[model samples]
Target chain A: MTSDLIAGTPAATGEGPQEMRSRSELTAKEVLREVGSVLRMSEKEASELTSSPVENDEEQTMIINMGPQHPSTHGVLRLMLELQGEKVLRCKPIIGYLHTGMEKQAEELSYMQGGTNVTRMDYVSPLNNELVFSLAVEKLLGIDGDIPERATWMRMLLSELNRMSSHLLFMATNGMDMGAVSMMIYGWREREEVLRFFQKVTGLRMNHNFIRPGGLAADLPAGWRDDVLTILEGLPPRLAEYDILMTNQPIWRERLQGVGVITAEEAVALGTSGPILRSTGVAWDLRRDLPYLKYKEVEFDVIVGSYGDSFDRYAIRLNEIRESMKIVYQILDKMPSGDYRIQDKKVTPPPRARIDESMEALIHHFKIFTEGFKVPEGEVYVGIESPRGEIGCYIVSDGSPKPYRLHMRAPSFVNIQALPHMMRDGLIADAVAVISSIDPVLGEVDR
Target chain B: MSDAVVDSPAPAEQLYGCVVTYSRGEKVIHASRGNYIATLKKAIDDSFTMCTDLTAVDFLIYASTNRQLPSDISGERFEIVLNLISLERRERLRLRVQIAEGEATLPTAFDLFPGTEAMEREVFDMFGIEFEGHPDPSRILMPEDWEGHPLRKDFSVGRIPVQFKGAPS
Candidate 1:
């Protein structure tokens, strides 16, 4: 019957028999006409019908909004998903829900106050944010090499610990997203211990604001070494417990092992960094590649993954916690004894005792506080290997007390671009796994 | 400082006719507005596979007093900065394109490096420098209905006075 329609149609149109008979062929218009005849409709009416190929299917696919407030979306991230049954054909990440205009605000604040501003961007890794900002400011001031050895060591110790804590939060949230509720408790418990150490050292748990342009906000507490040692001792066994809890569990492996796979080429093209890029078998850790803050002096390994899947990303962060612990221990062993901040008089305030005894010291302190020191006119871009990836600060100074322009090359912001690339062709159920695997701190993403 | 100078084989002057390159504290390439795309393509082909950052600095206020660029390169009101890194060589290079105020659009780097798509959009959103060929050239971090570019130097730092509930009306 189909062959009769094909032959009869070509004959009606006066087409060559040899060309028409090459195969059972009909143009889309002819096919529509044939369908029109089958449905007892006129050719004009059939030709007027317009529908997408997907709509022509027996079962139509659906479009769904995942979240600006869904449980599995981590923070305020929203995903607009196009789904065919359970499969996600296309995904668009709708962000900017947490935008606070912090970059614009940084311009009004002085360089001394800049640390406090940037430290809040990636609240999870606040010290890394502060460290990058300080480094950029120092580079603009041309005092990159003048930072005290003790301050450098302290910054390394605090930053690695921050990395550990950030990863621990990821372990917890990632576990919860995958339905392992107990891991939430375990992850937060370990993170609480790290936060306690941070509180003791910098007087704030989350946003320490300790790592400043010249040096740390204050000297470390006398018992900091032992406190960190205690944290170091407690983490290993808990890490082992997590391995037993989720790493080798059958269901965990089933959900993450082959899901959200992205190749190295795609990852780099999308500008994904941190675990997402490392999981794609690239050993590009900025800590090692572009060493800053005495990172070159420390000994540690850059953890990498074989298959760029959700499981590899999870495993890389888990192993990176161990590497960070190694770096922290090395910092403790080689703790330098010197001024924590540079005593340039312009950048740092004079000693408290000297401020009371000497008028010159008192004036220096007053000037440093009321009118912050000016940065030389220039611009510098300094990128550091934060827990998420390359958290960079691009500072353009105008020889004023305040920064001319300060912009953060937020790792979470850049890494989130890889979402649609990773989530394409994956199931809707696996979308949560993919999003959590990216470990996006929306504060950083939106800032 | 003279001993540390490592000259590029294809100098900016030789490769692109109008563009000039300078190293100030770091390697910086100064490209004219018209040759921005070609200069960037050369940098990309020279193994600068990663674009670490792309942003602009509005020199409207600091143009004359604070920064003293060579007279030939100093007059532009806005300078779009591109920081590129070569992963293989562990090296960094900076490209500064002096875009005049009237014609603030430059060719998009999306074709050379897909990563710059978001960064370019950000520059457009904040500094109002349009990328001629950007695929989705829309406000990224800001709301769609935002009024003016916030990062421009002239953008007012709007301050809203706080009002207490029942104290004074």
Candidate 2:
């Protein structure tokens, strides 16, 4: 077996230099090779930066471990940093502290139960995770176009509202990381309003598996429009307060202006999307560029930044909240009244009322809940823009209720790759800012 | 998932010296292990600058039944799925490369898309498919000392032994 072959190899213990190596252990030639390969740069470029040979170095560079437990590292992300006096020479993010083997778990869950599994991956924006998985399953079931108008618009509304709450949380953490302690309270105060609305709608604050495969689990609750309106009405003034507190403050600008900078080419090469990519002046929002659901019908700007620095990323997300508000308002104005889930008997189970009248309805409900509806025997990949970046779902079905294979292309996982390149020349103090700017949820990253 | 029956077969075409098949309206290219990197380079030349995702699927159980592929390419034990998107064209292209169980290795695409570093590591860690030229070819999610490829079908979902009151040992 493959497992035996892998275990049999004596060098199976050769786990590569997973951590950063110290200057004492690496020769000049080896240093050049390691730097060039780790950063994905040419040897010539790497050598030019390390012009002074390793032999003549006065102070030995030190490699230190930063948090799998550091509060500012944002949920158990460990970094192996090689620092010479405060300036970081190399940074390697050591992750998987949160891996519960969700991909393996997905293979055991049915299509109807899969949303509950994926929603927990990115705890901040659970709706988008569920949305992408549902879209992929619907595509495989060949019911992508048959989704009711109300369901599509409802999905859009929930997704946009979740983006707002997610960015609000980022505001809190980013502010806390940057030493603006009061901003954390203010950010959470505003974010609580949004999460309250989510709880009213989805019955949970964080991992709401309300957005199911065919459509939503249930329709909008009573007074949902008013609840959404309350959130919308309450946020603008608080956002303007944020503008005064951080956006225009001199200390805030000074701390983040040029720290952890990345170029447009580098951002694209790093496969970052959403605000990080937009912060590099690449206007690639999957909503505007790809136009899924009712995004095409809505009017909003695809905010982009030219400098690609920490400040650019910060401002991009700050403005994205207002843009999300604009989308939510449009959705409020245009939300169609119809069934929230599809009426396709194959994908959607019989309504609860139907079970009282007919035996077939009870049988269908029991069968659907227990066995789950089967998706076609094909593979499909679906990508949607989450608050962090592009969250993609790839599924292969082998003619069964459970997926043959399920993989989530987590945006935070890829975005964390840019950490090493971003932290290479920055100070150790700025490492927190770099990580906060990337805003990686380690649950998603490790998953 | 559907029952063990083949969907209507579609005609096959070629792109970048590999088979071009569509999976639910998305374009997919079935590249061999030898030309995987070359195909990625060509894709970059054609403006597929951003590699959205790189993942692998273990086909250990579905060796024969319910497998979807073109008539020409034989199904292998492992398939590497690469999803690339062109910002200019706003179109996505998927690349699938097959690897047999005995020789489960392919050249890395890190040179083309540096973002794939972690993803390739993940594929290696989970499915035991080695990328030949990968720099950090170690595990990403799993612990380095882990025993088996957890995602492969052969690797069972393990359980701790349970003790029951009224049962024979």
Candidate 3:
């Protein structure tokens, strides 16, 4: 009878996630690993924290699934929570529901067309994704140092603005997650203005794919500066309004201040980055510490938090919008005049006007679109600061037009690892706030 | 450019028995499976606390036109790349460990960097490169019952037949 039943199951035939085993079924070591205890503590220390004997523990603690559907999860992030009444005993994040096999798809797409695939991974900050992938490809092509001044500054400008827009979206969702319903409207209202600027510049609000390998797809549109200035000028008072609405509110402070706490040591060990890392009082911003592009040239403060909690994460992001604004102001002051992209004929296609007039330019454009430019046989990893965290792109080329392997080191994917640690011992109600604070984009996590 | 090659001890010539090589301005450390865990432990002690990214690449011969590896290290069917960042030193190190086709397993880095739990699971799911002693040791992205590793070059990208409404045979 057992054999007959086993024969019909998906487990015997290959279908379900096996990672969601109950905490009661897990071994002591497995529980430790699941809860992210090995992050800071030794095995003995980890065992001591989790191995405390409980009377009727299994009876008291019931296993429950929190989401793969909960709106507060950001997207399809299913967490299996072991709750001892109201307190969460253990939590395991069950992901991959949004898996579209993007890395595998990237292997099929040419380097020139790879941006479209990566851009969709972290949809909120698609520009950063494209920028990192482009930077890696450029490095492999041995033209890392040759990208024009205008292009680099333009990349910086767009990236910082994307950061602002992403943080604004976070403000909306984080507010909605915390039950401040109207703050959602206010946050989205501010963010749409940024996206409006994006649409004018990139022609699409999200997944623009405007930032390309050799340089951007095109130069900044006429009066683009004015549009950017408009956004830069308009955001402060609205952000100050957010300060009034959520930042200074007593209920907001009570809900987030001491909840979802993590330490600097644990945060680093779990490989959390961006606001999560900075929230732990570590001033480890990729833009400042490891300068990429013209980040070294820009002037902006890296916002950090003293306590690694939900409130700290929220405050860091809120302040980070201001910091990004600071960077944008400098970008405007120092926007240089030069070619928007490199003049290299091998990687960059000829100008559209040139194609209309010259036969050779038309052929070059055709070849680039169809076959794509070949990158040298080398591997390069380029990491940049996306709003969520350190988004890195690793590409391995085999003297081909397509990437042999294109891997995006998604911040959400790594940051999600720290969730169990953060949620451990916290109340079930606070879990929503914790997830909101992490600000994971499931697209990137699953991709 | 060749003449300007630094005569001084090549900054990080060797890191805990792993050969350090520079690839396009980034530092890479090549470690065999034997010393991979030990090197990682030492790397932690050396202040490379954060494991920024962990991924694997399947270099099946049919798809790979060329490979650029250091002279001494032989290329393999699968390579595990771990990008570690040292916050104190403000430096990044890339550790590449090559795993042979048949013996496709490496000890888990979970004991040191618990952050690698998900990444290890992803690698196992994608490339079928098992991280031995991994806590969960189950398929992550792909369903547990899924057979072939999707990221491997040999694995065919199969598609389901999309039957249009009112237009099926």
Q: Across residues A318-414, which tens digit of lDDT does each residue of candidate 3 receive?
A: 9999999999999999999999899888888998899989998899899999999998888889899999999999999888899989999999999
Tens-digit lDDT string for candidate 1 (A372-416): 999888777888999999988888887889998898999888888
Show the lowest summed lDDT stretch of 10 residues, model 3 chain B: B160-169
DockQ-based class of model 2? acceptable
**DockQ of candidate 1?**
0.19
Whole-model Cα lDDT of every candidate shown, in order: 0.80, 0.87, 0.88
Write the candidate numbers in order of decreasing DockQ. Answer: 3, 2, 1
Question: What are the per-residue Cα lDDT tens digits for candidate 2 across A1-447?
Answer: 233334434236355645666676765655654443534557576666654343435366778899999999989999998788898877889998899889999999999999999999999999999999999999999999999999999999999999999999999999999999999999899889989988988899988999888999999999999999999998989999999999999999999999988888888998998888999999999998888897889999999999988999999999999999999999999998999999887788989999999898888898889999888799999999999999999999987999999999999999998887778679999999999999999989988
Clashing pairs in model 3? A14-B145, A67-A78
List DockQ for all candidates.
0.19, 0.36, 0.43
The candidate that achieves the highest DockQ relative to the unseen native structure: 3
| Model 3: how far residue A166 lies from native, Å | 0.2
In candidate 3, which residue ranges exceed 4 Å CA deviation? Answer: A1-19, A45-56, B1-12, B62-65, B159-169
Q: For each candidate in turn, give its C-alpha RMSD to the true structure in angstroms.
A: 12.6, 5.0, 3.9
User: Residue-wise lDDT of candidate 1 within B12-81, one digit each (tens)?
Assistant: 3533344444433666767777788888777778878777788898888875645645445665888888
